[model samples]
Target: MKCINNEFLSADTYKLLKLAKAKAKDINYKYAWVHKGMVYMKKNDDSSKIIIRIEDDPTCMSSNLKFLSLNVNSYTAHTASFELLVTETKPHIISVVETWLNPEISVSLNDYSAIRRDRGFTDESGRYVRGGGVLCFIHKSLKSKVLFISESNHINHPEFIIADVTLSTGSHMLISCIYRRPQGDLLDKFFLEFGKLYPHYNNVLIMGDLNCNLLKSDRASNHLKSFIDDSALFCVPFGSTFHTLETDSWLDVIILVSKDKLVNFSKSKPPFIDGHDFLICEYKLGSQNHYNKVVKFRDFRNCNHQALSQTLNERLRLTDIDPEMIDLDELVYFFLYQVTTSLNIYAPMSERKICRPKCPWITRELKLEFHERDALYKRYKRTGCQNLFSLYKIKRKELKIKLMKVRNDYLKSFLENESNGSNIWTKLRRVGIVKSKQSSPLDHFDADQLNKFYANILKKHLSCSRDFILNLPHLYSKKVNFEFNWSKIDIVDVTKNLQLTLQKSSGKNPDRLDLKWLKDHIPQVSLFLNLIFNRSLETGSFPEAWKSTKVMILGSNRKLKSLANIVLPQIIIDGNLIPYVNTTKHLGVHLSANLSWDFHISQFLRRLFTEEDPEIRRSDRLAAKNNISFKMPNFATTTYEHSFVVTAIRLWKDLPPEIVNVLSLETFKVKLFDFLISNE
Candidate 1:
């Protein structure tokens, strides 16, 4: 170590700082120790002096931490792929470099919150640099804030985005995403800024595509090598990240230096296929925020539906234990017991931790195709064969098409069959058509607070509802159709309605009323449910479990943070003016203003307004595109043959393009029959 003076440090035009409890700490001045994001190295340099910072003895305050670093050339263009990465993969912090974003361009992900620094800022020459930027996508559940952003006047200066994220144990971790151009002398510039920021935060993780490959013997590589001399920080020993036909190099790196131990870690292959293979490190940071609810789920894929049906049919012999032979309640109870017992034997519930969003659309075939494409790419990269590269590109394009088709098919099937507004919105939200804002940090309101606030307004109505027996008799006295009445609805009708209800999982359910289980065993449960419902109505009593039919009080709420800036004039009723508050509750719905209520219910109102009588024959299957004229299966001797064949061909032609291209005659026949039966 040289004398702690200006001349020693001024030897380089740029510099960086680092972490170490070394003998060089005995120095004065704020910029006393040289920062360590860069280095200088020669081939013959002494190997013993190169202080490796792997921290063989682990020390850490965090319980669970995972980071994914990628050099996404442009995040905006690849957002759909990136969304899959963030949601499917469990990463606490996602660091992306080379985002190629600008101020006017907006990027939003459903569950992950983004902090981006675009390279639009002017350099020393007063011209904006075209294509380098850095960003971090922190999971929404974590408490985080932007700590610093690097804005150097030099055009070739390294770009950085720094964030301090708080773990569940309330320990803060400084995350930095850095990106540097492959230019000259910028190593010093990068480390100079990084050096100044490193000392303040103890728990630090630096990730980026810094363009200086440490494996190479060059001036920039030497600079990085010298930077690693400090004992506190270490770059992960990752193999060649950036891959091409003729070259493979470690241009991307994850450099971490923290006081806490992070020894228990693992890496994963990134979901997306790109030139730069992403670096994923799953770290045991600290205590994890236990938010994911452990739910009991039966693997229906393994369950034999036919066996379940046969068992139920054999067990419920109506003649032996018929309604005439036994009491209604006893018969119902017996049927329920038999059904539940059969289900228990067939599809028993097993506890599973939800690690990712449910993507049932990602069928086994699609997943296999995805893996095969990845394999092709990896093989092409390894062998550098032109034919393999061509095949990889073809597979990649085909896979993209299939992915889109599968997702669209999932949505189509859902929307066509399910009409429940809440379930529809839930699906849309999950699929990301609806924007999901991060849960507000400032929200302190709870159920009790809301209840107390509403109680005050309710006090004025206390005098209006004292006599319930006299007022409640009108509903019982009025005559109603026997089929539609609550006292004696048909079991068939109840079962039909239940079929339309979306399947939902339940937790802490004492009665074990999982909607999925009920739906799966619907045929067996219909008679039992009908009997119970009729019994309840006849007895003028409600089952406690069924009382939960009321809408959940904590209905989905839109993020209120965006409404903070909205200020409206006071409402004047007669001569008195009523002051406006931040949130106004109308019929249990939180809204910003009176006019917002209009916007809130506008969809419903629009439907009502535009409700002209639709045509009885709404479907134009015959008019759809590529309406092929079908040969009558060599039996076009009657009107039935002409109408049926033509209609079937039209429908087949109108199917999704990929589906039409690959559909077999047998599948088309089966689909056509089903369509005819459904329409009938």
Candidate 2:
């Protein structure tokens, strides 16, 4: 964006200029773009700058109710054509087989998540082989968990991926994308393992280039019919999906097993270059979640905990029945109600609406260009006009190249400036490379089935009886006189234990009442607890409510898992190799082998003193023999301790006493500041 002539502008500079350009056409000069130290008209150079506007929910998000299956010969090569297709159709789930991709090559689509199992093979004879990979692209509106089974040494396994997807409306679909070699193999073993990966009752959607041409009578189709349950329906329309000069075979297929009937099925030429056509089929799905874009959270930044605490105290004091006389559960309920009630009145849930346009870089003008190009392609196809076909090809090529550039520019600036609640890790997740387990949504199961699964898991523990322990032989002890009176227990001890509990509440599920509010009214809560405990002791029965706790399961791992270099077993600490039960945390930072924030902090301090004329304020505490003093500013809270004024003053105060004392610039400012802060 060289404003001198608007020529010879670099890609990044042009992108940065567009970030500052006007969103709408206006004569009042509200927005302007700067380039090469000069301001210019914010209009796009070639076309009208058409902004991509998004609603609370986009039409494409709801319009996509179909699943598209294609046989992409080489995904890496056909990415350009495939991306344009995604932009147009916006299918909910896209399945690809024969990607001819390895683990090194990654495929990604914006707003759609990719689950892939690249072809794995060994070339022992110095030979090369290709053409077997399975991939599924699920929209971000759905939640997907992938289960990949690694290749086994003894068997030539089929390339397949099981992706359990939960729709926005909470309904689940188990999509399995598979790719089999055209050559015949043992279908029994492959199907057996595939069945074991997913539950039997799952609403299954099986799609891929199975190499089973239904045109001719074949055993492969029969095997599929037998394996898929009675409810299973073959959705691929009768046609030659794959075409050649001499022969056309219906190799690509889709088999769905669900109670709901199929809504529609249609076929279209793949946006990519392939012999196989796209098999697009739509199924009835549950309602889309309207509130998905509205994020909910509590805005605690402006809340006053002290006032909330006082209100809770007043409510607790006004309870109709005395806590000491009421049942223990009743007392506990009343106490929790008062605290949570006050908190809700102070700080409540707030929502921020997020509008993410599917293709923000593809402005209205670009969309028109696409339509015009498509029209040219149709006209050329209808007629035998070489010139028209050539023009269409040229336009298509230009649009593809422009799309890649515009998308890159828009995303680069969007990621930098957009305040959407996403972070670096979220962006990484979008790449779909991180190997970790995610909870699979319930596939074709009801609430009772889920409850039964958990029940079966906990049956052994819950069914354990006390009869054996009661009848077991035990050593008898001499009777000892001990005073067991809860009435004499000091309220301070109760408050201390309660405060300790609150302090350890970190990493646990958030409670209804904020810990700040609870800690604020420690005495009042302690009084209620003390009364319940003393009464429980007198009655010799603990309230069931006291034993209640929340449990969140992060995947089942009762059996040991192999770390293999993915994680370290032991670490050298204090000249010893000590084994740890789990990862260790320091403050709010995760300590890793490569680096941590501590390393960066140390580097900052080192450069501050070691480098001449450094950017930082230059007095280091460890660099001098005695602490120095300087003009200091007092911070009201620890939140401001790292601010420039505070850190600069603290470092300046660390200078030598003689230099600090003799200085006319507020001699002994640290002491004066400390006195003033203490008095305040």
Candidate 3:
């Protein structure tokens, strides 16, 4: 028998070997192989019921049986080359043999020579030189009775072989053996194919040299993202596994299915090969003998076993500690009580949701009150004040003095005014001002009031001084820090001089009066003047001196009179006229000429006619007396007499359509006023 490529051994295997040696006398075995040809044995263990066998080869029957018997039985069995072939009679024995060899060598052992007896390998030039194929076997297990074989035929494509282990537990396992190309687009094709293949398996355990890093590749990441979008399977949380000593990257994984079943499984460190690590999983198969049995296996030895167990324990602990199962309302109430007690305040009612009374405000209030209470309690405790009332009085007196300073500072502006007095009555009045209220006389004159009389005396003196300074124009101006010297001349005289200077500069013409300039130089004064003039006009009480002068002086300046006639007439009429009259007719002819022709025609007609009917002879005589042209009518046949026809025809021919429309509209009151006034 030959076994090849035995490279590594585990520490537990050594212990097992030692145990085998100690039991060697019972087995009566002479020797056993440790690894590929490194054999050791005890001469006395030939009769041993169990034996230790370790080898890398799968085709050797002796080695395979020894490996199986060690796991199935306790006693050591030493055999040099024992072979017991059984037909149907010893089926159990045959079953055991089959179990051992089936897992170990089914995929690896091939009778290719039988199929190609005359074939030989080809030389470099393609002539036949040698004819053989590479073969390898893989075993994957996920759950009970879930096992599979992956075989590489001719060192190329790996084919998954289904086993006939029908599980009573209704569990199915998936196994995929991937032998990737060295470099190509083959990875994309492999993943595309795997996505289609994955849905068929219930429990998948894929293992092999996939030659692909799932983490570093974008396509792999995207595929994993898609896989996780469904919550059925979860990836294990081992950081990295393979390529232990290589600097580039590690963890070419053997992915598992029904991942929640193996949730606590993890990878072992210090790879099986020095440069390639493998995962160890501790999975719960099912309940056995009324207790859970965790099956742990690792592809690597000499790795941390405790980590795997710890991972399992943590997962169990998390499941046990999940807080979602607790009653949340009770938890919230308890937390509320905790916060309220810490704050030394009552918790807010559950119905109130704005700013909760149980918030940081309560905490801050408690902190402040505690500081105050601590000081008072210390003082009362030191003073030996027996009654609560007496202790409170003491604390209140102390607090009152401290708080009085704060109140004084708050009212310092009102108190510091020279006109005000710092006394009970004045303080009450000051408080009223702060509260925005009126003062009372009893607040000053009460006999029991502290400093009441003095406060009243001071207030009276302040009132008199205020009035005196107000009456004194110089002092009033001084108070406002104005440069005007009121004592040098009467304030009225100074104002009159300023007005006269303005009027002279304005040249008795409203058009030349720079209202903007007046506003800039003396905004308050100008505003006051305008207000007075407007109010007088509105009340029909405008002083005849100003009004007459305004009209006459404005009429003297053609530009001023034109502006006043057009703009100011409307302003005055809109402001004061209960039943307005035509002011434009009152305007001089030069002002009337500036009016629109509609005003000229309407004014002329109103002035010319007063009654509905007129004597033709009288109209004709009047037209002749006014030096206006007239035409006499020959009314021998009709009662209607046509007189003043020449004047009427002349006026009708001169009137424009705009003038006609203006005369026709009854609501055109301003137009009527302008026309009548201009005609007058």
Best by TM-score: 2
lDDT of each: 0.58, 0.57, 0.34
- Please write out the lDDT profile of model 2 over residues 1-680, one tens digit for every residue: 22223454433344434533443344433345444533355344554433332222222233336788888788887888788877776678899887877766777888888888776564788443566777789877677887554464232566777767876445677777877767646356657766675565346687887777777767876665566644345554647788887888887788776536477787775423567888888776656444335666666777887777677667877355765567767776776777666767887668988644245578899999999999998898679799999999999999999999998887677567755454444543443324335432233444344434443443333321234322221212112112212243567878888777674524223234455545656776777667666666554445544532211111112211322333432333223332322111111111232221121112222232244443223222211212333321221111122234334444445544554444353545566576557667
RMSD, every candidate, angstroms: 25.9, 25.7, 41.8
Residue pairs that clash (backbone atoms under 3 angstroms), model 2: 628-653, 628-654, 628-655
Model 3 TM: 0.22
* Candidate 2 structure, TM-score to reference: 0.34
lDDT of 2 at 606: 26
Candidate 1, superposed: residue stretches over 4 Å from native: 1-296, 300-338, 351-373, 376-424, 432-443, 446-448, 462-487, 490-511, 515-523, 549-680
Q: Model 3, residue 399: displacement in angstroms?
A: 99
Model 2 segments beyond 4 Å from truth? 1-60, 125-128, 153-156, 197-202, 229-231, 258-261, 269-274, 288-680
Question: How many clashes does the backbone of model 3 have?
Answer: 31
Counting clashing residue pairs in each candidate, in order, gives: 27, 3, 31
Residue-level lDDT tens digits of model 3 in 116-225: 01112345696543212211222211122313333332323322222222122334444343333223233344445555656776655443334445557566445544
